[model samples]
Target: MLKDPPITVNVFDEARVNHEMTVELAFVNPVSEILRDCSLTPSGTGLLQWEELTKLPDLMPNNRVCVKLIIVPHKSGERTLLVGFDRASFKDIKTSCIVNVKP
Candidate 1:
């Protein structure tokens, strides 16, 4: 079995106008493993929780990836946040990295 890569996904809270945000990570393999052996760590929480990947799709050989992460806000200010991830995984997709936007 190939071990999954380690990734760090960041969150930007458009409401805070600062860096306060919540970020959780899940993984999808073309082999149909959704969130399998995945984990999430919130900033300053100092804790990591393991979660199951329920809705992840099967990974196909040479297949690309599309991550749908859940944005959980720790504060009560604005409830929405802009989402994005690094392009180190989806190299063949031929798309530009999405710029952070207002939510």
Candidate 2:
């Protein structure tokens, strides 16, 4: 699992309000497992949520998938977002990201 970088958003200022941020993730499945489903879990209150994304391609052996995550932050604080996937032949895989929110 690999992520681009940490995101910073300003949500308090009325003039320059930032309500959302986008995150890019690149992952590779080394085992022979079929990815069935994928979802994102944001930590803390309703400060952040993942926007609906397109379906992920079936991850075969030694295949990589790049996904874009649109996250909406409703408050001002730092939060962590977790990305999880269900595999047909193996345990699920999970990854996380840290975001900085300025008020």
Candidate 3:
């Protein structure tokens, strides 16, 4: 069970441009609602040849899990990767991460 609410997303503070990077996502469902089809998907843009998206198991109330995502920034500077949930119902959740990418 998670001691927080909503969800939490995390990624390395910095990354090298044009290099593959991994972002870790921590999912928390502490409320009384059940989250279905928890997965990560690309934004369809910023196609930096990122690795394939990942899928996660459904989260019952008071459940938590951690997952990772692979990304490759095309350009340097602060890069933001926008992702979505596979279920579509929890699209409004915190589904994005930013990395200070250096060239």
Candidate 4:
């Protein structure tokens, strides 16, 4: 179950901006074990918030996991937030959202 649909971010007249957001990922079936690793890749000028890589614990069936993300825009323009998720025993998933930077 995923919640909190993605939205557009507005950075007004700033060279760099940081925004905090959350994402939820859910499992459909019961698995022996589950692990999650998340990352952010920017198409333009931007960076991820976290410095270290970490894995989440196992999740049960029909359960959801929430991830905290920090988005930073290095320049003023249109940017894209590329979020990647790696799950144990599952294929990697990716999602992208648009961000508008104003100057």
Model 2 clash pairs? Answer: none
TM-score versus the correct structure, for each prediction? 0.29, 0.59, 0.66, 0.50
Give candidate 3 misplaced runs (Cα > 4 Å): 1-5, 42-53, 86-91
Tens-digit per-residue lDDT, 54-93, candidate 2: 4566667667776665555676666655555544443445
**Model 1: runs farther than 4 Å from truth?**
1-52, 75-103
lDDT of 4 by residue, 1-103 (tens): 3343222233333334554333332223234444345332223335443432334555555455544444455455666655444544444444565566554
Candidate with best lDDT: 3
Q: Write the per-residue lDDT of candidate 1 for residues 9-83, one digit (tens) a residue.
A: 444334232333344343333344332322222222111123323233444444444454443333333232222
Q: lDDT for each of the candidates?
A: 0.32, 0.49, 0.62, 0.42
Off by over 4 Å in 4: 1-54
- By TM-score, rank the candidates, best first: 3, 2, 4, 1
lDDT of candidate 3 over 15-40, digit per residue (tens): 77767777766766655877776675
Whichever of 1 and 2 has more lDDT, that candidate is 2
Name every residue pair that clashes in candidate 4.
Answer: none
Better of 1 and 4 by lDDT: 4
Ranking by lDDT: 3, 2, 4, 1
lDDT value, candidate 3, whole model: 0.62
